[model samples]
Target: LRATHPPPRPSFCWAIHRDLFHYCALNLAYMAPSAREVDMALRLGFGWSLGPFEQWQLSGWSEVAAWIEEDRRAGKTLVDLPLPDWAMDPQRQVVHTPQGSWSAARATLSPRLSPPWLKRQHFPLRLLGEGGSTAASAGRTVAESEAARLWTLDEDILILTLRTKMNILGEVALEALDQALTETEGHYRALVLWSPDPHFSAGGDLKGFIETYTRHGLTGLALAQERFQRVVQRLRCSAVPTVAALQGYALGGGCEVSLHCTRRVAYTETNLGMVEVNVGIFPGAGGLTEVARRAGLRALAAQSPLQVADYLQEDLTRILRCTVSQSAQEARSWGWLESGDVLVPHREELLHVALTQALALAESGYAPALPRLFPVGGVEGRAQMLAGLVNALQGGQISAHDFEIGRILATVACGGELPAGTLVNVDYLLGLERTHFGPLLATQKSRERIQSFLETGKAVRN
Candidate 1:
């Protein structure tokens, strides 16, 4: 009888894993370079998050070596090179020490010379260790939660690290931030918000929002939004200097958090934006308010009202389209990054630069910025912005929901029914955000867009 069923297919991951093992084995036998060097080459040259040797070590070196041996015996491996003795020995680690990593060629720990690696060694106390210790011993750790931690540096600087997945801003993170700010009042000279994750923060917890809305309805979502806004407001009004060390994607609430900080030190690769509109909501956490504030300041500097009008129009375009800056330079052009903000060329140098700037600010007797009235376009500005959206809607250039979002954004950005060139405080702009946010969130199309994004990670125009 002929077999009708097709044979089981090999996994792509397994094939890649096997190839990686073979490649590392060949390199170790012939090139005789340190595992760290190989890892660094792949990271710097190829932009891999993890090198072959690093991935192997992460997957358990001995276990992977044994599997390779089995494959070699079965004539399945790409190469016949024997696994290194050091790798098979469970006691010997490839990169175990802070000072250096193990080299197969030298059969010794090679000294690590990377600037970031060297800098990290200076700070011996992390609030939470690799083993997940949360003990607040010897003033090293002031506060900690599952989502975030507040730890001290060498010069009375508090480092608040968001530990959530993608460092998403949630209730736990917000609470931790509030506690960190409270602790920083008289104790720490400066505060730095940073993370070791690939992303500084992807944004607010979309999954959390879905769960909340599904189980507890709009009221629950509104309460959560309110809590987030209050915490961010406190960050803006913080007595001490707050520095944001930004890299990777700083979108939505993450961008808002950085926006409120005293100064931002960004990596050249950093991507920043107020992208909540893609998920069918506006930046309710003072993001639009900050943009409006910046636009007002720029307009004040301009010699003509035409320049002021252009600035407002540009910001309006960004808000409605959810423009995300591709690089630090672009972010600066978009006005998300300020002129005074420092841009670090190396990812490793971001925290160092940020810390230095924070210390400098503190030493220079930095004071929190006082709340002041800023110029807004007011009712005429809102109408002017809406006119373009109305055209786009009539011309079928944008969906009805897009027009609706633009309208709400226009209202918030223009300061909600005030006269042209009205001067309003930050709190008033913030209030407008909260007020308009609910209506957009309440819409069925907006909810659909949010749900689609959460499920597939793709924005739905509807």
Candidate 2:
């Protein structure tokens, strides 16, 4: 007769979500004897995004469950909530499901089911002309020196995995990727960029950036940016359909890399962000440009002809704040992802879905994005953004350096002094980004922040 949980206010959803999760978790822990039943009950009853067991897996079952165990022992319990059986056993903390088993403690996903397409041939590639073999089994070699590798799936799709340290984009890795793309051209039906490494990528190597800037100064940094730009742009406009199988931390340049793909198949647990602001620089490698482009497209889609400045304010706020999407769904909300981008329920299904999507696009005759002009936010947007920055600075909410960064971002986003009616293309935004970014690399605050990050693995805000 009556609805169980009333529709919540906008501000109340977070509290409701948190409270309901805790309630369900506690009830399921003690009452329901079976893990699958508990999972099913919570998912079906409340229409939860993830069941309690899955949420437990994501939140570190062993540690959080251990806390529950200690709390139970101390009699600091809530209602009649029972402790989960698996919580009592350290070994059983890693929950098992038909799709896969994930151990939050180990950060490992061991899939019980493998996709049908993966049953085909597996090939190992040795890039950079280094062909030394050591226990080459099933075409996968254990090469210590190689930075990139390609695997042929179903003899049609070529999956390139960047194998550098932390999967960071080094010069060697970039060079190998470019060569792979060039060689695989017209040969493979589709190319999928993927890695089973803990992170899709942490981003470009900051250590490499520091080394280059220290040694070659601005000239070296400019050259490196050019190479990075060229490779990413090439990927963006590739003839063969491309898909990035993304998971874990895809931040900064890693985020940029995905922006260049024909399509992105993101794992639900992806932690995606454009975090260059943390390093005291704007996104130089087509990331900010991509964001601007997406914002422009959003404005074009609106019915009421919303001011481009309104969209710019919202989008640039995310960039300036280094907003990270904790899940695929959230990434979509942030406009980092397109409506057409695929969201894989299980991380194990990411590559398979990507491969399938790539094949479908290829079969449908994939068309690369056309070179088109976008409407820049222009003079009005720039004035509004600068005024906002000034207000924030006056309020002592941001540092002077941050204000300068915001100004640079505003200039780039609005196409740098372009008139209100002028249409700006991708090249214009990219050029503005590169021009501003190079100067930041030469700044003391940026250098200090980069150095601090390198030395202490923490951002130094000046």
Candidate 3:
């Protein structure tokens, strides 16, 4: 059906040839993401630069072509990464600003070839061509610099030495992660987790957010969330011995990123927080779920944790789990220093550590597990947790209504059976979370203060 472009101008975009069209099919919804399931479905969907790729991506390509071309003709750009999966590695990312990854489709351009026009505009691509691995990876010379370096150990582990300044949430970072995952096998035994600088990451590109939102409304939010969530999910579940070497400032999504790793070895200078609530949004990108599992309930999550302020203040403030050291030397003293752990003191050492870790993981092994079935904490247990929140809402101990609404929405999202990843899609079950969480969230005001107390950090000013 994709090839017959004859007769009337029943035109199509690039007209994906028979070979490319063969890969077209419905992506199976894996009940469990394992074996063929993880790499299941059409990853080609992600790779093909949206265009008049008539042969491959019939409808999706068509839509993309129209959208991108419209933006370009208006001299406007979305400033979003084309390959969002690469942004997971913050230290080794490059931004090609003022250029869209996919070319304007109307001009009948193929994304495979870098446009001289875009290069003339100083398109910030690495400018590698479509060719052999060695030819594609030819080096670029530069003076001494402060960018974090990455290394690999015969496709086993991948180490990331993040220092300061450069950001990694753009498409370049996403591409790197995607490529690594595509190439590798599994985890490493000696995982190194230490950074040269105190900070891990600064989260997604904020300026990009500012630029895109001004032009696109909810569309910008949707796109950003999709890309952000991709990194969040990958980091949370990559099949390897993951370690975060934290020296400082893993805030917002960065904090969540740290939790996804198996080990979070931090210097005392590491101050982690999911402060998205202060900005009128929750850490909707699996931050809460990851933190809950990693650090227990003390680690605050977005929106959901507003209910447990007292618990966070008293229990989580101190005695948080894992290893925390005032300095790298002391970290070794702690049990955090496993039998063969490597210590990285400077920029070079850290990059070597990252290289070794990432490459080791690539060749580690692969037996991807089935997606975990989220427990309801038993029937009595489920009732108890639900009752406590209900009582808090009724007795005015808590002011927000989102808790109950989310419970109801989440329940509806699963039709009573719980799924791990469903809660993030709160809007799907409009039967509950979407319709109710906001009003419930806004239940308290000056006069309409449904419930208020020093403990309740209510959003209502009136």
Error of 2 at 108 (Å): 27
TM-score of each: 0.83, 0.71, 0.40
Residue 266 deviation, candidate 2, in Å?
0.6
| Candidates ranked by TM-score | 1, 2, 3
In angstroms, the error of model 2 at 4 is: 56
Kindly provide the TM-score of model 2 when superposed on the true structure, using C-alpha atoms: 0.71
What is the number of residue pairs that collide in model 1?
A: 0
Query: Which of the two, 1 or 3, has more TM-score?
Result: 1
Query: What is candidate 3's CA lDDT for residue 354?
Result: 52
Candidate 2 lowest-lDDT run of ten: 121-130
Q: Report lDDT (CA) for all predictions.
A: 0.78, 0.73, 0.38
Please give the ranking of all candidate structures by lDDT, highest first, separated by commas. 1, 2, 3
Candidate 3 TM-score, C-alpha based: 0.40
Clashing pairs in 1: none
What RMSD does each model have against the real structure?
A: 4.9, 11.7, 22.4
User: What is candidate 3's lDDT per residue for 229-323, written digit by digit as tens?
Assistant: 56556654566556666655565556656655555555444455555333233344455444323221222333233233222222121111111
Per-residue lDDT of model 2, residues 102-196, tens digit only: 43333344343335654431322211112333222223321224887776647788778887777898888888778767755757778888886
Judging by lDDT against the true structure, name the best candidate.
1
* Separate clash counts for every candidate: 0, 1, 41
lDDT of 3 at 91: 39
